[model samples]
Target: MSDDPYGVDVVACKSRQQRLLAEMVEHGLEWVVLTRRESVQWLTGAYVGPLFAPAAAMNTEGRVTLVLPSRKTSLTVAADEVLPYEEKWCSTLRDEQRAASNTVMMSALPIKLRHVGGEWSQLGPDLLADCEGNVINIEPTIFRLRRQKDNDELRMLRRANDANRAMYKLAREIVEPGVNELDVYNELHAVAVQKLGEALTYFGQDFRSNARGGLPRDRKIEAGELYILDLGVGFRGYYSDNARTLAVGGEPSAKQVLAWERVSEVFPLVESTVRPGASCKQLFEEVQSLLDKSKPWVFNHHLGHGVGLAPHEGPHLNPSWDDTFAEGEFFTAEPGLYHEELRAGVRLEENYVVTATGCEKLTDYPLGL
Candidate 1:
C-alpha cells in the first residue's frame, strides 16, 4: 500500500488495476486502451477539466486517454489544452508510485517547466486503430467494479451530499412567487460555492408548474405552481445527486398536494426495500404501484439509477433490468409524477447506499412542500 492522493486510496487503485489485468489475462489480451474520461479518472486520481478540451478546429475527440497493459506498462496521453496540469499531476502521482510512469514527455510550449525525461512509446494512434486485435474495451469490467463504493469513496460521497443538501436548502428558501426562475437557479450554485468552497459540477432548475417541465426562464415564479430543482456536487472525484419539487406560492392545490403525498409515502417504502439480494425490478414496480391511479403519473425516466463517479451508474432502477441490489452499491430513489395537462410535476429524489441489512439514506433533507 502507498500513500493516498487527496481522497483516492492508492492500494485500492492498484487493486482495481489488478482486477482489470486479471480480466485481460482471462481474455488472453496483452493491453487495453481507455479513452473515456471516467475510465481515466478511475485509473488515475487526476482530473482534467473542460479547459483541457480540444479546440473546435483541432477536431480531436481525445481528452485524457490511457494505455493499460496486462502488466505494469501504462501511459496517459493528455490533450494539448490541459497538457501542463496533466504533466504536474502525473509527476505527483508518479513520485509516490500512484501513477505508473516510465517516461515523462516535456511540453514543447513556450512556458518553462522542468522535464522529467524518459522514452514514451507512440501508442495513441496504433492503439486507437486496434489493428493488432489485442486491445479490449475496459468499460464493462471497470464499470462493474465502480458500482460498489469503498470506504474511501463513501467518505467523499458524504461530503458531496452535504454540499447538495446545502444547495437544495438555499433553493427551497428562495423559491417564492415574484422571484425569477433564473434568479433561483443562479443563486443555488452561488450559495453552493459559498458553502462548499467550490462550484457544483451539476445544477439544474425547472419552473414549468403549468407544463410537464421547462428550463428556468427570466419569467417570475407564480403562486401555486410546482418547480423542480435537481442538484449534484463533485467531492474528491465522487458525486452526489438529489432533486426536490417545491410549491411556489400559497397553499398547493389538492392535486398538487396529493402528488407530493403519494411520492412521499412511496419514496421511503421503495427505499426501505433496498438490500442485498433485492431485485431492482421489484422495487421499481412497487414504487409504480404506490402512485395515484386516478391521475396521470407520467414517469419520463427510470425509477432511479446508481450514482457515483458518474451521475448514472449500474444496477439501474428499472423493471426491465434484472439487476439485484448489492451491498456497498449506491442508488437514488427518484419517483416522479409529471402531469403534462396540469402543467405541474412533483419529484423527490434521494441518495441511498445498499447495506447488509437494508439501505442507508445519504441525503437527509426533509421531504415536503
Candidate 2:
C-alpha cells in the first residue's frame, strides 16, 4: 500500500514539469531552477520546511533534477534525478548542510548561460552565485499558469475543502456562550483529522468570536457574539479557502439577522457577476457598491481571492490587481460587515471553481447565521 498522504498524482507533477520546460523553450532559456518553498512542492510534491529549501532544475529537454535533504529521500518526488545532501544523523549534527546543498546544487545545475529562467529572488546565495547573477524571474509566469486547475489539483483541493465542510458543521454545533475560541479551534482541528483520516499538512484562517477576523483568542465568547471561522485548509500542496459565521447562541438579534441576510445576498450577486474573462476589479467595485448602498454594515476587504498552494493566489477580486476571472480557476468570495453593535458583525465566504458558464461552489456547508 502506498501511504502517500494527500494522494499526490505523480503524473500531474510530470505534466507540470513539461509545462515549465515548454516555458523555458519559449523564453529561449536552457535551464530553470525553482527554490521557493511553494515552487519546490508545486514541482516535486515533497514538502520542505522553512529550515531548508529544495531546488528543482528543469532543462528544455524535459530533464528535472531536485536537491533535497537526505532525510527526506523516502518521500515520493517527481524528478528525473535527485541530488541528496546530508543534514543531520542520529544524535550527531552536521553544520555543513548549507555548504553541502550548495555544492550539490552546483553539480545539479552547472549552467552559467546568459538566457536562464528561474526564481531569482528566492535563490540561496550559493545557488544565486551559480546562476551567474543573470537568472530571469519567471515566478509570475508560473503563477499565471497555476490559475488553470488540473484534475489532480482539483481532486486534492476538493479533499481539503471537504474537511472544511465537516469543520463548519461542527462549528455550528459547538459555538455557544462562555466557550473559548481557542477550544473551538482545537475542536475543529480534531474534526478535520477525523474527516481526512490523517494529519493535515495545513489548516489556517480566522477562528475568533466577537470579532471581525483574527487568530483564535483565549477569551470566552459571549452569547450574542458572532463566531467567524474562515477555513484555509491544505491537504498536500493544495489548499481550500472558505468561511462560515455562527451566532454564539441559538438566537440572534433582529439586527444581527438583518446583517446576515444582507451579507448572504452578496453570494448570488457574486455568482452572477463572475465568469470567464470577467474583470475582478470591476467585480469588487460592483459588490462594494451593493454593500455600501445597504448602509452602516460595510464590506471592507478584498472581495475575493484565488486559492491554491498559497491561500491568496492571483485572479484576485480586488482593486489592487486588475485580474480577470479564468475558467478552471479556483477562488473565494467573502462578504462581511464588522461592528460591535451587531455583536461584532457577520461574514460569509464560499470557495468556488470558475466554470465555462459561471462557477461551481466547492463548499456546501449551511450558510445560516
Candidate 3:
C-alpha cells in the first residue's frame, strides 16, 4: 500500500502553510505551537499519531508542556525518517535529512523571543513553563484558517468520495432479508479493507424497527428491521462519510415510502441553497418549511455538516449555524425522517462542494431506496 494514500499534492500543502502563516500574522499571533494531532497534520502535513497518550497523561498530571514558534514559512521536516514509499508523494516543501531527538526538538526553534499559540491540553504545563517566550492561545485563529477548504483539499475530497461510492456499491450487493446486521457489517468491512486495502475510520450500523426505537444495542441485523449504515473510510488521514437507510424485505411500507420521498425532496432543496455567498441558517429554515408538521418528529438532526480530513468539520447547516458558505467549502446534506412507533425512518446524505455558481455532489449513491 502507498504511504501517502490520500494523494496530497505538495504544492497544495505549501500553499496552505503560506496562507496559514499569513493569517497568523494577521491575527497577531507571532507563532503557533501545534500539539493536537489534527492541528499538526493540518498545518504541516506531519503524520504524528493522535494525542491519546498525552490525554491519558494529562488526566493523571493535570498538565502537559508544549513549545511552538512563529509559523515557519520555509521550514521542512526531515526526510530520512520519511519512508521511501512516501517519497513518491508530491510535497511543496524541501525535504531535509536532519533528525532531532524529542528532548531537543523544541529548543531547536530558530526564534527565541516570540509568542506561541497552542492547545494546553496536548502540551503539558511543564513544557509550557520551560518555554523561553510568552505563550498565547491561538486555537480560534487556527480553526478559522483550517475550516475553509482549498483546491487541493477539494481534489482529495473528491478522491475520498470516489472510494466511498465504490465501497457503498460493494456493500449494497450483500444486503438481503436474512442478513444479520453483523453479517452485513462483516461483508462491507471485508470489501472496504480487502478491495480498498485501507482502514475504515468510522463505520456504524444501527438497526431499528421505528425511528423512535433509538440506536441498536447490538451489531446484529435482522429482517423486518430498518438498517441504517453510516460509514466513513479513511484514505491516508482524510475521511469520507455517507449514510443510507434500507428496508430488508421486498418493499417498504407507505410511511417508509413517504419518509424516503421527503428526504429526497429536502436533499435537493438543501443542495440548491448552497453557494459561495449563501447562508447556512437560511437554507436550514427553508428545509424546515417543507416538512409536514403532522410528522414533526420525523427528523431528529440538522440538515447537514461539513466533512474533510475529519469526519465532521465546520460550516454546519442548521438553524443556528452562523458561518457563511465560502467557495470551495465541502459539506454533507443528510436529511432524514423517522417515527419510532411506526418502526420506520428514511435518510439520505450526500457530500457536496460549494462552487462559484452553486454546489457539486461528491457521493453518487442513488437517492432511491
Candidate 4:
C-alpha cells in the first residue's frame, strides 16, 4: 500500500489519464496503451505486478493491460490481480483474455492510430496480430511531462528531506572514535525505522575514515581522523541525499579545515545562482572558477544534481549540462575537495529548491569542523 494518506484517488488518477488521452487526440492518435510501471502509475494510479520477470509465472508476455476509452468504460484485470480503480469509477475487472479483447475492441472504436508506452517492443508482436493500425511510442512524451514536479510532489519531497535530516543527526550523535562504519550505518538505520516507520523507502550509509583513503568502505574510525557520512533517505517515493565529513576527537588538520571551508563557501555561491531561467552550465563554470583559486586539491564531481522521485534526477550542475534551471525544481549542491597526498577530503552538501527569484535551501545544518 502507498503511504499517501489520500489513498491514490482513482478519480484524480483518471483525470490525469483523460488529460493524456486528450493529448493523444490532439496528436491524431485514437487510442493509447500504457505498460511501464511509472507510466501506468501516473496514468491510472494502478499498480501492476511482475514487470521484471520472465513469461512463465509472472506473465511477462505483456499481460498488463490498459485501454484509454471503451464502450463499456471499465477497468479490467486478470483474475490473480487486484484492480486499484475505485468502485465509483467506471472500472471493471475481467479475465486476461477479456482484457486483451477489450484492447482490440478499443482499437476498432473510431480511433485513428494506436499509441503505446512501455514494453511496447515486447507487446508489439501480439498487438500487431490483433489490431492493424499505426503503433507509436509515447515514452518520451510521458517522460517530459513527469520530469517536472507538482505541488503535492513537493510536499512528499519535503517529508523526505525531513527524514534525511533525522538520519544525518543520528549519524552525528553516534559517530565517534572507535565506531565502525557498519556500526554507524546500523545506528542511523534504527533511527529511521523508529521515527519514519514504513514511510522510509531507502537508507544507505557510506563511512570512511580520512586515513588510508577517502573512499567509503568497511573501516573503523580512529581518534584524530576524519569520517565521511553519505546517506540517502526517502518518504513515499521521493528521495533526499546528503553527505558530511566529521572530525573525531581532536581538531581536524589545517588542510582538512581549509578544504571544508572552500567547499562550504562554494555551496552558497551555487545556491544563490540557481533560479528560474538561469543556465546550469554557466553556474557550474562559476563554481569551478572558485575551486581553481583553491587549486591543487580540486573537487572532481558535478556541483549538484536534481533530487526528488529519483535520487539523481535532472538539471545537473555541470559544465557539460546545458539545461536551464526552472522554478519548483529541487536539487542538491554538494562540493568536495580531495587531496590524495594528505589522504583526507572535505565535502558538504545541502538540498535546495529553485524559486522564481532565487532558490531556497532545504537543509539548514552548520558546515564547519
Candidate 5:
C-alpha cells in the first residue's frame, strides 16, 4: 500500500538535519560524522545494514555527504552529495574497505576535524588521525532530539509491533511439547515476515525456554517448561521488542502459574507509575521489589529500555543509567522471576510510548503463561 517501505520522509530528515547543524554550532564543529547504521539512517533516511550502509558527514552549512561503494546506491538516500568508491560484491569490509572509507570521509572533512559523533564507531585508522580535535559524545543530544517519534517513524515502529504481536499469537498456537526450539523460531520469523509483507531487516530478542533468554537452540522444548519468546522484529530500520511466555503441553505447574501471576502484576504498577519525569533507576527498584528475590528464583536483568532504529535505545529502565522518562519516548517494561522451581523462569514484557498524562501502551496481546 505504501510506495516507500522504509517510510523515508524528507521533511523529517530536514528537521533532524537542522538539529544536527545546531549541535555542530554548539560544539564549534566544522563537521560531524556518523558511521553507525542507525545514526546514518536517522540523518539520511537510508535503510542501511551493518556492512554496507555508508558513512555520513554533515557540515555546519548543512551540506551532507554519504560515502559508500557504488553498488549500494540504488536506494534513495537523503544526502545532498553521494560519494561512491570502487568495490566488488558486498562482502565483509577488509583492508581495502577501510581505505575506501578513509578517502572520502577525509575529503569531506577538514584537515583537523572535531565535533560531536560516535567515537566508538568503525572509523578507519587514517580517519582517526584526522580527528585531532577533542571528540564530543553526541549520543545524549541525539537521543534527546529523537525522543519524540516523527509520524513516519511511528508508522514504521507500529507496524513492527503489530508483527511482533502476530508472531506471539502464532507462537501461542504452535509452541508445545516436542516442538523443537528451531521450529518455533522458524515459524515466528516466518509469521513476522508474512505479517509485514516484506523481508525483516532484523528479528530477535530471545527465543529459548527453561532459561532466561538466548538464541533458539535445536533442543526439543520439554512438557513442564516455560518457553520465553522475547520476540524482536526489525522493519524498515525500526524495531519492536516485547515478549510472551507460554506453558508447554498446555499445562503448567502451580509454582509456574504463581510465578507468571507475580510477573503479570508488574504491568499495572508500571502503568500507574511511568510518566514523563519519572526516574528510571527508581522505577527499576519498584519493579524489582515486587519480584521474589529468593536465591535462584530472582529477577536479575534490566527492567526495560527504549526501542527504535536500534532495538535498545534510551530512557533505560536500569540502575546503571540515570535516565529519566520524557514525554514521547517509546520503551519496554519487563518483569520476571527465574530458576528451576518456576519451571526455569517466567518473563513478560510490554512496550509503551510515554504521553503527557501517562504512557500509552503499545503492546497488544493477552499476557499468560
Candidate 6:
C-alpha cells in the first residue's frame, strides 16, 4: 500500500518537467541532476523524506538522486531508508507527456554519470569524476521556474491552508491558564493527524509566550501573558505557515491592545498594496512605517516572505530586495510586536497569491483577541 496521503497530480508534474526540459535545452545541457530535496520534489510528485528534515538527510550515505534527460526519461536512485516506498516511487516517475514509461530505480549512483546539480559535495568520487567540469547548477533555473503556482499547486496550497485554519481555531479554544506549551502542541498535532491521515508529513506547532522570550517549555500559561502560536503543516510536499497571538486570562491591557491593533492592521495595508509590478522593498517599507519602533514592542525581522515548497522562499519582503511581485506567486505577510516589560507579544500572518489586478488570500482565519 502506498503511504502517500495525497494523490499525485500527473498534469502538474508533467508541466513542471516540460518547463525544466526547456530550461535544460536553452542552456545546452543534455541531462539535469536534481540533488536538492526541494528540486527533486518539485520535479517528481513524490514525498521522499520527513517534511521537517533537511535535504542533508536525503544526501547522506547513498543520496536519493533523480536524473532527468531532455527526452523526459528519468532515473531515481533510492537510499536504503526509502527502499520500502520503491513501488510508490516508481509509480510517480512517468514522463510529463502522460505516456506509460518505466522508471529506473537503483540503490547507488552510476559510476559514469554525465550532468549533476545539487549535492555536489556529497557525490561519490567516481560519479563526481565523471561529472567534474560539466556539472550544471540548476538551482537558480529551477527556483525561477518554481516561483509561479500552477492550477494544481494552488489547489494543494488551498488544502494545506484549510488545515492551518483548523489548527489556529483549536489553539484559541484550548490555550488557557494552567496549560503547558507542549500540551497545546500535542493536541494541535493530533488534530492535524486526524484531518490529514497519511498526508500529514509534519505537524510544526510552536507554543510560546512572552514569559521566556517565546521559547516553548513546560511552563504553565499564566494570567496577563501574551501567547504566540506559530503553526505549520505539510501536505503532499507543499507547506502552509500561519501564526496568531492570543491574550491569556481576562481581557488585554491598554498596551497589549495597542500592540495587537498595530500588528493586525499592517497585514491588510500590505495586502491592499500587493499586485503585479509592485516592488517588494516598497511594501516592506510601508509595513515598517506602520510599526511604532519607538515603543519596546517591536519586531526586528523583515515584514514578510514567500511560502511554498519551502517555508521561506523567494521574493522576500526586505528593503534590499528590489524584486517586484508577480502574478501566481504566494507570500506571507507577518507583522509582529513584543514588549518585555508588559510581557506581551502580538503577531499576525496570512498567505496571499499575487494576481494580475491584485492578490487573493489563501488563509482566511480570523485574527483578533
Deviation of model 3 at 237, angstroms = 1.3
For candidate 3, what's the RMSD? 8.3
- What is the C-alpha lDDT profile of model 6 across 17-86, one tens digit per residue? 7777677667666456554557766766555553211121222122333433222223232222232212
Give the alpha-carbon lDDT of every model: 0.61, 0.81, 0.58, 0.61, 0.81, 0.66
lDDT of 1: 0.61
Which of the two, 3 or 6, has more lDDT? 6
Model 5, residue 86: distance off in Å is 2.4
**Which prediction has more favorable lDDT, 1 or 5?**
5
In the predicted model 2, the residue pairs found to clash are none
Query: For model 3, what is the error of residue 166's alpha carbon versus the real structure, in angstroms, after optimal superposition?
Result: 3.0
Q: Which stretches of candidate 5 lie over 4 Å from their true place?
A: 89-95, 110-118, 128-133, 137-140, 143-148, 293-296
Clashes of 3: 18
Question: Residue pairs in steric clash, candidate 1?
Answer: 209-343, 210-343, 211-343
Better of 2 and 3 by lDDT: 2
lDDT of 3 at 348: 72
Model 3 residue 241 CA deviation (Å) reads: 1.1
lDDT of 5 by residue, 47-125 (tens): 7565564678888789888877677776676789888765544654554765776587778776766654653556545
Estimate candidate 3's alpha-carbon lDDT, on a 0 to 1 scale.
0.58
Clashing pairs in 5: none
Please give the lDDT score at residue 369 for candidate 3: 65
Model 2, 33-135: lDDT tens per residue?
7867788777877776656657777877888888898877767788888888876667454776666776787786765655677676676566656454457
The candidate maximizing lDDT is 2
The C-alpha TM-scores of every prediction are: 0.75, 0.93, 0.79, 0.74, 0.90, 0.79
- Cα error, candidate 6, residue 244 (Å): 0.9
Candidate 4 minimal-lDDT segment of 10 residues: 51-60
lDDT of 6 at 290: 71
